[model samples]
Target chain A: MMKIVLGSLEKLDFRATVENIRVVESVEQLSKKNNEEITYFLTETEENINAVVRNQEHVYIPATSLLASHQSIGLHIYFDLESYPFYQKVKEMISKEDKPKGVFRFRRTVQHNRNHSLLTGDLYTLSSLLGKPQDIRVKQTDLSVTPSHTIILMNFGGGTMAHIEYTVSDRERIELEWSGIKKIIEFDSDQMVSIQSTRKPTQPLAYSVDAILASARKVDQELIDRLNDFSRLINGGVYS
Target chain B: MKIGIMSFAHMHAYSYANGLTRLPDVELVGIFDDDIDRGKEAAETYHTTHYSDQAGFLALDMDAVIICSENNRHKEMVMHAAKAKKHILCEKPIATNLADAQEMIQACKDHHVILQIAYPVRFSSPIQQLKEMIDNDELGEIIAFRTTNRGQNPGGWFIDEDQSGGGAVLDHTVHMVDIMRWYLNEEIAEVEAIVDSYFHEIDIDDAGLLTFEFANGVVASHDASWSRFTEYPSWGDATIEVIGTKQTVKVDAFQEHLRMFTNEKKSLEYVFWGNDMDFGLIQDFVNCVKEGREPSITGYDGLKSLEVSLAGYESSKLNKTVHL
Candidate 1:
């Protein structure tokens, strides 16, 4: 049996999904578990990650360990724009790109007054994707009577440009327009991703949560399959 | 109701003038712009008379005047309208600064004129539904908001700091800030922001990320950037994510649009299909004038939102959080 230990359950809504796995309350108990046991650490503290890594005899997974197993996992690392320092860092990093070429626009519309740090996570991902160019420039312009109805233009090297327009005064939809692509991707907060493309002019994909979940599951399963293969190679087929 | 447009500097004057013509029992009396040629052109386009002199424009027997002047000139036009005792629907930000905004509000109040700020996003149907949900506590206690109000930069006087006051920070922060204040019914206590002139070869800053702390402990962040490209499918978007203790909701005001790709344009374009928010806003102002009721979006609302934007600029300059 595959016995998995969870470090912390606070604020985690995925508890029900992990019901089949063995969950221990304390790190001591986790440490005592057999080498075959897999431990998952979800806390933000560096101490917990250190504790797990220190126990080299056992197989442990930090929150970020799974990130390397997949490409899109980086998108899940929420960027907290609420923190002043982090916001500045992000701004600086995005500005550092010299002659960056590409259009990256992120427009997020929300329903109430809430913390948005988590929503900006994709900014880093987008910046990373665009790479460093010869020059990058950013400009903000206000275009509407509504407060906060502003657009941010990012000019990368060459003719590539990215625009992010945000308005709390409007409805809620996360829309992204990329250069060289014939379609725009609209991500609903409910985890539904729809493609509005010129190729399928008449068949705009309706927002569907199941479709997104299914795609995410496929990626997750691929990661799991790779882990299973690694386990088998390390500890013989018995672990598999 | 006989109404006059104060200036043609801002492009919305055309839409407002056209909307007035479509409204029942409302007359677009005349067009008044500082530039005689521009004013005359707008008047001809709207089939109205042009008034070159400020005194002559105010002297007209008008029920109200819509101030669509440049950012710096809003105070002068609004004060003039107030003196005329005409119910006013002034454009956003109220004024370029807190002092100017307060003066405009006080003048309107002293003159017994209804001062409504043009915030059409409040009139969006999806936004109204979101407000209803918040009011009903469907999301439980509100926690924070992440919003973006972005659009393509309208180059011209907009890029000139003297004419427009500030760039994206000043122009963009007010709309979503107004919505946030209305939804949470709380004042913003703190602000931290980053404003940069990273795009375009302009003198003014065009991109900004503003964070806020509400008096009620709710925190929010906004991306008020004029960052849209010419090839963008639509003008831009107004999007917000409402995070509450119990649940979260997202509102995208411009999502209800149809995508079209034609040979003439060569690129894809989004044709919005939602109800005309501008029409709703103008109708509300007209109804308030006729019913003798205070406008739903008041001058104070404009002042409060403008304060946040001004604070954003202060925060950027100081590289620290500003207390409202």
Candidate 2:
């Protein structure tokens, strides 16, 4: 059995709020304050995540990188938007807009520690909603030293236009349009599973805890891959 | 606690009356309406006395009055009730304009009585939960907001500019704007809007899209309209979507329902089941009066939210953003 030591929290039973995993258990090693014996740390941002493994050389994989492990969270067409809930309302708005674009502007926070920026995470999960993107472009709105607020517009294969907004804000949502028929996704934390959208009679998108473990195996699941891909794309991956 | 209702002009008075009935400790002392027949009918339905004279009703041994008068008549009713030393719960879009709303608020303050605005949507448990989360900063720093409060056009005085103030923008905008402001704890910095009579033949606007930038530069856009026509499954919806650095939260406060396909005349209906927003508001008001505390939804909140809807009209007319 792989030894997993918990942090901040004394113990947690994932029997509820998550599915398909028992890798989590209360361990004796957590009480041993030597600091070097623990190989895996399961902690939240409030637990002082930086002081743990993230600040040191123990290797830190943020929720954005870890949640990207599953291909079901992958960029593939589940079905047309017609099959989606609120179909008529979405259809009515689409017909009204001559461009017929579906925007998904959302924000992602970076784990800043001097030179390194937590490169990739939320964009991959939200981009999957529009299926695989046929093309992607970056438009930086706010002038900052470290791309503090960036507006990335994507053209998906299914003809949906997504605008991904990144910055510090008190809320998070995936909108169909800036001000049209929209679907807002609420999360307690970024690593939440069995997620429920509050309205539009929001459909819950659930993932198994096993997928989180599967994500650890795929090194490319790190946000760094998307950042590299964006660089390559910007360096002429495809010409308009 | 003894509470009387003033005016049967706004239909919400009926719901407020029903809410009064649910509370074991509160009594519906009487009702006063400019329309005698309407007041009498409501009094009979709620099993309360009807006072045709506004002075007669205000003179009653009541602790508070719920003013469900016309949008234009709110100021008069509120002022009368305040001087009578009765705490007030006035309906949304507190007055037709800012000055009246301000004066109404000031009178309540001077009289040292509680003045609550009837923004029942905030009593929603999910919305309350979201507010708690926002208070705790569970989502991080909130960035932008998108909201919708669409409803079927209730014909009658609601369409009359003199009685109802404005159309869809006035009727539907306050509830959501009040919620947004409460959640962010911020005042609007600017307003931009497009208002038109697209759904109806009325001169007053039946549709509007309002955009607001808060004092902190947090932006929000609200689609307030009376576009939900007859034969729709429900009367309307109150939906909100917010984006923050941490996560997004979206809620349709009235979405708790079972869709019913009926063979009856009404055809489509949503059999709603959830925490009663009106009852909650009534209970809170009763608690405020009993506990001698401040109201949950204050007159100042009403004034600020009203300021946005009023600005919307000006923004549409000027074809430019109205800076507050």
Candidate 3:
């Protein structure tokens, strides 16, 4: 799992901001005292401007050239930008006053996606409509083949900022261009399997959970049938 | 290579000056903003020369020039650079309109010069890797994708339609559109989008959404906004996600350096914010110029992206789909 440590001094009182940002050291010590291990470390943002994050083993400092005042204190582990979700969610929950002086921090893991597309009926239709080409013939079924390493950058709040990508073969492709004022979703083969249904007012939670559980119970049978079909198609017991 | 900046009117001009000075092989030749005070300030802070006119600055004999001028002024700057035959790095939305952008491209081509639009995201390491994975068929097929560039309102000249061409969509949409074309390696066949003023006091739309359908049956959505309030911890970011037949991957390309702290009675806190895209972009432009190659994102890419942005504006006004 990729971990990111972020700190910011939005409050004019520098002492309080530094004090708040120093929590990473304690967190590191806590990881050592306990069995929780630290894998990768990234030192970015203003905290590292004064050589604050240095000489630490496995710590990677990408760039310090463009550091600016009046921004957030943060660090990112690994180069994958997707791992910053916990910080974003925590940042979103923060109130204006509590942001600086009122110490508040939270952490959450992004549930790695395992499904291709978890589209509602409306979303599916809209997606299909958008896929049509005026000069050429395009089929929805043809678009069904999965690209690897899909990412969906959605704006929970309304804005013209979202990103989606996929890796087909070894080439990373930007499947969608940035358009303003729209919802965004990115999904590919490996990440598609984990997409559980989103909860909604119309659908009761208990009912959806039960339905999902029932589907899970059939996995064994489904696997057996799929294996049998493959064997028959291949004209041999390839499993041996 | 010694590089200098010509203007500080663009949002990215200050960072370009800093980056040029920071790179090992590059020396900062100084910066010049049309506004004399702005030029002097950037020059003093960046420790470079501040020239009052193009002739004086071009005569400084710098290896390259970055035109971080207004959208309307890009062609003139490029023409001057063309006459000088110096390599040029430029900001995105390369021109206020398509004709001007074309002229800039032509001038560079005629002069046998490198004209690279400073679309740093194309040079982003992770994005480069993502492109590789997609081309390799690790994912079976690209089903769909979405992208967005949103942030706090950029007032001043950005609000003027003549100065900026349009509002949020115009200012922000081109980069994403270019990224999309680069990723798919295909043309955008048709598009439908909406532009509107919401939560902004300006005459133009502070928010917009565009939907695109590629010829390959891959669907896309792009969102651009400048209405986000700065009171929020961070303003906004450029993010992309691609959904394929088999899996999903998301790119959070927002640049920030942050830290947190807590004591006996408290919790999380923000220590700093470092949002820098120019460092990578400047390095890329210099590399391309040194190597005698076109940029990963070229001026033509800027023109196409701007076309998509403008198409969205037209679609929203007409409430109809557009073919590109």
Native contact fraction, candidates in order: 0.00, 0.00, 0.10
Query: What is the Cα-based lDDT of residue B120 in candidate 3?
Result: 77
DockQ values per model: 0.05, 0.03, 0.06
Error of 1 at B158 (Å): 1.0
Per TM-score, the best of the predicted structures is 1
Q: Candidate 3 chain A vs. true chain A: TM-score?
A: 0.20
Candidate 2 segments whose C-alpha is farther than 4 A from its true place: A1-240, B263-268
For residues B177-273, write the lDDT of model 1, one tens digit per residue: 9999999999999887767765566788777777777887676767777777677788888988787655678898898999999876537899999
Residues A137-192, candidate 2: write the lDDT tens digits: 44332233332344444545433434454544322322343322232222222334
Residue-level lDDT tens digits of model 2 in B1-324: 899999988888998899999889889999998798999999999998999899988999999999998888999999999999999999888899889988998999999999999999999988898899988999787777768887788889899999999999999999999999999889988887666665666788876766677888677767777766666677778988776667778888888999898898768788789789988898888898999898999988999888899898898787666898
- Arranged by TM-score, best first: 1, 2, 3
Query: What stretches of model 1 exceed 4 Å from their correct place?
Result: A1-60, A63-240, B264-266
Clashes of each: 63, 16, 114
Global lDDT scores for all candidate models: 0.65, 0.65, 0.55
Cα-based lDDT at residue B95, candidate 2: 91
Report the Cα lDDT for residue A40, model 1.
41
